[model samples]
Target: MMHEILRQSLRWAILVTLITALLSILLHAASATLLRGLPLWGGMVVVLIIILVGVVFDMMGIAAAAARECPFHSMASRKIPGARHSIVIIRKADQFSSFCNDVVGDISGIVSGAAGFAVVVALVVSLDFHEGRWLLETLTIGLISALTVGSKALGKTFSIRFANEIIFRLGKLLFILENRFHIRVFNVKNKKKRKRKRGVLRAPRTD
Candidate 1:
């Protein structure tokens, strides 16, 4: 079991690193190409999208952690859409939180910074702004940082407030993928037998 856990960890680490690296390259290349001819506002749009991605996933991490399992159990017993799948994800809350908030969120931050730099370079070259180049670059990077951090800070509050609802909805989406689309992305088998055994042990005496 320990070996299997370690193997899974290593596998996830390698896969995440490769995905982040490839995404970073693609984002940088796309940003450079798209911003080369776009106006300043257009470039800013790309930066905003990156920030949004980071913020959304950060919120998802919080929601996943904060979600209650009892509600999921009720939903699952009632055969609600995605309830069982939600329970599966909620069971591994720590791992899901790390994946959503740390891995994907950090990657988004890196990609955003890269995109910001690309935009800055594009602007400098297109406008031939020799003077105050350092200042312009500083402002651009600073704006990107502010937006990314500030949005996440604000999102944290909302996530905590609406955590259950958010996670419930996410579970529904995962359910659709698993049942209709034939993709069990979370790969968790239902543990109903364990719960049932516990319930039997706790039952009141009928004697």
Candidate 2:
């Protein structure tokens, strides 16, 4: 459980970092353009600080959403054969699914953020706008790229096909464990009966 929690936290961290970096670049460009008279470095630093704060808030929002959407607490409570015995198994499977989702989300965020930042940087370098105008243009391009990439990644990652694969594998493992336990119990009962029958047969022959 500890390992899983740590892994989830790391995934969130990666996502938050990507978002923060992308936003910071865009915000910096905007601020620089709007406050053109100010020194470039100072404006950027201020924007960076604001972006960092936004990142913290974004992370908190994600954490809250994760808690609310946790499959272990929700789906695992549903009826299944031998529900009591299967609770732990179901919860573990849910955890695995959550971990996979987090990993995919983080990767998607990184890819989108990188693409957005690169586009903005390239545009800013190529264009010959005044300081304020350049910043505005850069921010616009960054935001557009971020949205486009993020939407594409989300669609690809959360498809029905991938979801079914994970669910099917988890269900299969749960069924196998349940069957194995019953088989062992049955074998033990048969062994005891065989011992008793053998003793009775030998003793009766003496009688």
Candidate 3:
């Protein structure tokens, strides 16, 4: 078990690092070119949008972790695809939380910071805020940080309150994609599943 845990952890570290690097580069490029062209308010709007995405996913991660197993079983018994996906999320809540909240959320925060800097640069160039340019940049960065943290703090309450419903809805979406488009974002294999497969392989052939 310890060896397996270590192996999984190592894999997660590599995957998350790669994903973070790719996303950071894309976001930084976007900030440099796309956000730089926007007006101060427009850039702030972009920052807010990124913050919203981070907060929403953070809430989703918490909700998935908090959801009970019985509902997933009931939904699965009904042959629901979303419930099936939700079952996997619930089974590996820690990993889900790390992916959604830690990896994605942290990336969003970093990108938003870059966007905020772009906003400041835009303001400094377009507006006559040359007197306290440094101060303006500092305030912009501070405001973005405050909003991001505040939104996540508020989102946590909602996540905890409506965890089951949120997870169920998310499951439905996953179900649709998996059934209709055959797209699978996550297909984690549990130890029990591996054991069952092994048992079948080891059993004497009836035929």
Candidate 4:
């Protein structure tokens, strides 16, 4: 289990780094060109907009993660009959939570790293350049940061949605199995009825 966890962590780290790097490069290029034609104040406004977008995306990612980890669905399955089916449903739900935690942790880490890089870039640009150039640099950094956060948010949302769907399907399957198989593994009514019949049969030849 520890080995599996470590492997998953490594994979997530690498994926997040690659995604963040690619997005940063693309955003840096695009923002650099776009901000070139804008006035200093206009560039600052654009940069702030980008930062706001990043923050929104980050919040969305967190929300989706929270939804994925929620135990409501699992709890609902407890009302289902049949111990075997309930166990399967609960296991699937637990797996969903585990996946959510890993993916969300990686995304959160990426967002933090990207935000730090943006801040550093902003500070450096402010010190190294003046007026329009500094504003343009800040805008570029902000755009890159926004892109990184947005991409992670989108990816996480997709993952969470997919996981939820799987859990739903699993729950449905469990219901079907319970109805069709009538496993009676934990059917209290069936067990009690069988016991009563047995008792009647064994009640001696009182006839």
The top-ranked prediction according to TM-score is 3
Ranking by lDDT: 1, 3, 4, 2
Q: Could you give candidate 4's per-residue lDDT for residues 181-204 as a string of tens digits? A: 854322323223443344445446
For model 4 the local lDDT of residue 117 reads 46
Q: Give the whole-model CA lDDT for all candidates, comma-separated.
A: 0.84, 0.44, 0.83, 0.50
Better of 1 and 2 by TM-score: 1
Write candidate 2's Cα lDDT for 52-78 as tens digits: 433333332233223322343343356
Q: Clashing residue pairs, candidate 2?
A: 33-132
lDDT of 2: 0.44
Residue 75: error of model 2 in Å?
22
Quality of model 3 by C-alpha lDDT: 0.83
- Residue 106, candidate 2: C-alpha displacement in angstroms: 2.2
Candidate 1, position 111, lDDT: 79
Worst window of 10 by summed lDDT in candidate 3: 188-197
Could you report the Cα RMSD, in angstroms, for every candidate shown? 6.3, 15.3, 4.8, 13.0
Model 2: weakest 10-residue lDDT segment is 182-191
Model 3 TM-score (2 dp): 0.86
Clashing pairs in 3: 82-171
